[model samples]
Target: MKNKLAIIGGGASGLIAAIAAARNNPSLPVTLFERNTRVGKKILVTGNGRCNLTNTDLTEYHYHGEDVGFVSVALSSFGLEKTLEFFADIGLLTKAEGNEIYPYSLQAGTVLDLLRAECDKRSVEILCDQYITSLKKINNQFIINDIAFDSVIVACGGKASPHLGTDGSSYQLLTDFGHTLTELYPVITQIKTETDYVKQLKGIKIEAVAEIVAANLTRTCIGEVLFTEYGLSGPAILDLSRIAATNTQNSPVIHIDTMPEYSRDEITAILTKKANKQNGTLEELLTGILNKRLGQVLLKYAGFDLKYEISLLSYKEIKKISAAIKQFSFKVTGVKGFQNAPVTAGGIRTKDFNNTTMESKLCPGLYATGEILDIDGDCGGWNLQWAWSSGYLAGKSAAEKLKNGDKND
Candidate 1:
């Protein structure tokens, strides 16, 4: 008799795993279950509908976890090159924008449609709206939603976007099955500040570098920073918000350098020259150089008169203003919750699963992958790459083990 396999969660990772498993053994029965009436709701919204399918640069530095060695193994086994090849083989051409890879058609729906079509072509069964409330090892078979299978793979994602159907319900279910989970938190989220400067600068966008220093590490990211009524957002701010949100000590302070490429002395010299040539007020001189409201606020914070002419300013005052502009700092009071987060920071601990196959070390015939695992990558397509790589390995490995009649308990 052919072995029966069941995959829970019908998102990106679950669908990939089902397709891969069926491809390995066409006669084996593979069933996919999703809680929502439809699958791939999250995939449709990724990359603003363009779907950053994967990152061409898949490096260890882009991911975070307690078990770095385990993650390294997984990446080496199925890296970015392999992912590109796999999709191309399935008739989905991909293109790279900077470091992010997207479908050639530039529509996320194309990727989703191809995967769904592949599943159909392989005769994989998909059952939507089948919410799996529990999982148990009955005798020797795995049980999910009262259905028994010889093996099961859990691909339920994290709780970052609740509307995407990954509301973190799998964490409790896995814990009940003797798996350990790290304290979950929001990653790639926006930060909120106590000051009202954000409201004043709302709708203004600028390029800046955001630096976050913690007890043991300091990181920096350079990108577009956007002002919202609540606080700071955009790529640069979200990159550092994860660290700030996870720190349990004092609230994290972020330093923003609006002029990242220029030195403080260089900026000062330019400002002095412009002020001397124009004979204009501080506010007037900096009006077009920076955001008008931000310039006024910085001048106020530095105890400089916005109406003062450049020639009237003392050398010491000029130095102080330059320093403030170079090292603008703010304390992050809190981070936006999972509702706005791009990914969850924690999930099933890596210790419970084999990094090679994503199979449960504690429970044979059980596996976990995707955001359900503790592994989370940085913003640029790393998380989706993890989903594809892990899903491929898990599905193929499970099928091979069952085909060989290897049932070690």
Candidate 2:
């Protein structure tokens, strides 16, 4: 009898794993199980529905995990070039914006449709609404809800977006197989600060540099920073929020540079000139330079009354205002949690799985991949890249092992 392969979770990694396994071994039967009503439900929401396919900067530097270097083998096996080619072969055209890549149609649905089409042509059986809760290993063959399979691959993702079908429930199955998990944290989420000033500046959006100092590691990102009632959100904050989420013990602090284009000295000189001319009240001094409300808040935070005349401001006061603008710091209390997080930071420890094959070192014929494996990437399409890379490696390796008739350890 021919071997059968079972893949749990029909997310990005599971879908790609089924395709790779079925495509590599035509005779092998591959079944993909999804808890959701359909597969790729999470794909529809990525990149704001545009579906960021991959990134040009596909390096190990962007990925984080217990053993971040473990990704090198899988990435080297199937990198961006192969990913693009595979998508193209399945009839999906792609476009690139700077370092990020997306579907030419600019619709995430298009990408999902193409992947499903490829799986269909490869005869990969897709079973939806199969909420697999546990697996049994009897005589080296895995049993999923009483169904026997020669090999099993778990790609059920993490707890980042619980509503999207990956609620991190499948982690228990791996733990049942003698695997361990690392401390989990939500990443790519907004930062909740301990300040009342942000509440007054709510709804204000500005291009600024956001820097977070945590665990003695400093990370900075320059983009749009949106002041929310809860705290801060936007591209810049989300990019650096990982550090804050992971380093809660070290007391993370985020500093925003409202005017990145101007140095502290330049801002001081400009403010001094305006004050020397007696341009307007302290409230009106930064009207043209910043949002009126944001400027007012900054001045107030620097201990200046809005009714105070700019001409009465001393050199020391001017320096203080400039310092506030250049380094507006806030104490980071926490993040928005997994519900708002784009991806989870920690997961199953990578040491238990072979990086080249993504197979379990403890349990032969069992494997884990994607966000569930403790390897998460930065915001720029790197997570999906890892899913594809690791999934491809796991599927291909599983198929090869079965083909070789390798006895289970």
Candidate 3:
């Protein structure tokens, strides 16, 4: 009789892990268990349903963790070319938008469909809504709800978007088995600031430079910035959120350059040149130069009297307004939280696993992959790539071990 291989969760990692296992070892019986009624609920919402599958510019610099270098092993295992080839093998062609890769069909559901079809074709058992709240390892057999499996892969994900099925429910499984889970925080999410200025400028979007200053480190990301009733969001915010989330104890401050195109002196010169009250109100001075609402907010915050005509600005006020345009700083109060976060920052510590195989160092025949592991990447397709890369290694290694006749302890 063949021993059964059990995989927990059915997200990106579990799905691909199942495929890799079944495809690599056709004789092995692979079973995936998901608590949700369906799998890939989180994948459906990735990249706004367009599903940024993987990044073309694959590198370790894009990822974050206690040791970002840990991802190199897994990423190099599947690699970018192999990942794209794997997707193509499934009959789903992809297109590259800049460095981000998306399906040719441009629907997240299509990616999920291909993965599910492959699982079905390979006969990988998928048990949906069969959420076993807990499990026990008895003699190298994972006893879950009374059924035993020779091997187990825990890819149940971290505590991001709990509604999609992960509430850190399985984190305890690792801890129970002697794995340490670091602090987890919602990453790649919107940030809230300590200012009422956002209230009036809500819904305004613009191309600006978002900079985060924390722990003696300053990083900048240039992209679209969205002003929300609570604070800031959009590409710029999402890109810098991980850094902010990781350094929250340091009280990170976010600074936005409303006019990144111009230097401080250049802006001051422009203000001096346009300082003509005869033209219109102070608000009118910034017309056509910035978002109407954003310009008004900046003008008001610059300590200039709104009633003052554009041409009547004093030398002191002109310099102050120019400085404000170049650097609109906001104290980051906090992130939008896990509910709004697309993924988490910290999870099961990487030191506890063999980076080469993603198997737990504490347990034999017990593996982990995806966000559940202490690996996260930038807002683009990096996280998904990590999932694919790590899953490939885990599935391949687990099946190979089984085929090599590693007996159940």
Q: Against the true structure, whose TM-score is highest?
A: 2
Candidate 1 CA-lDDT value? 0.84
| TM-scores of all predicted structures | 0.96, 0.99, 0.97
Candidate 2 TM-score, C-alpha based:
0.99
Winner by TM-score between candidate 3 and candidate 1: 3
Candidate No. with top lDDT: 2
Higher-scoring candidate on TM-score, 1 or 2 = 2
Model 3 reaches what TM-score against the true structure?
0.97
Q: For residues 260-340, write the lDDT of model 2, one tens digit per residue.
A: 999999999998887887666898988888899999999998889999978788999999999999988899999998988
Please give the RMSD to the true structure for each candidate, in Å. Answer: 1.5, 0.9, 1.3
- lDDT for every model? 0.84, 0.92, 0.89
lDDT of 2 at 381: 94
Candidates sorted by lDDT, descending order?
2, 3, 1
- Model 1: worst 10 consecutive residues (lDDT sum): 68-77
- CA lDDT for candidate 2: 0.92
The parts of candidate 2 lying over 4 Å away from their true place are none
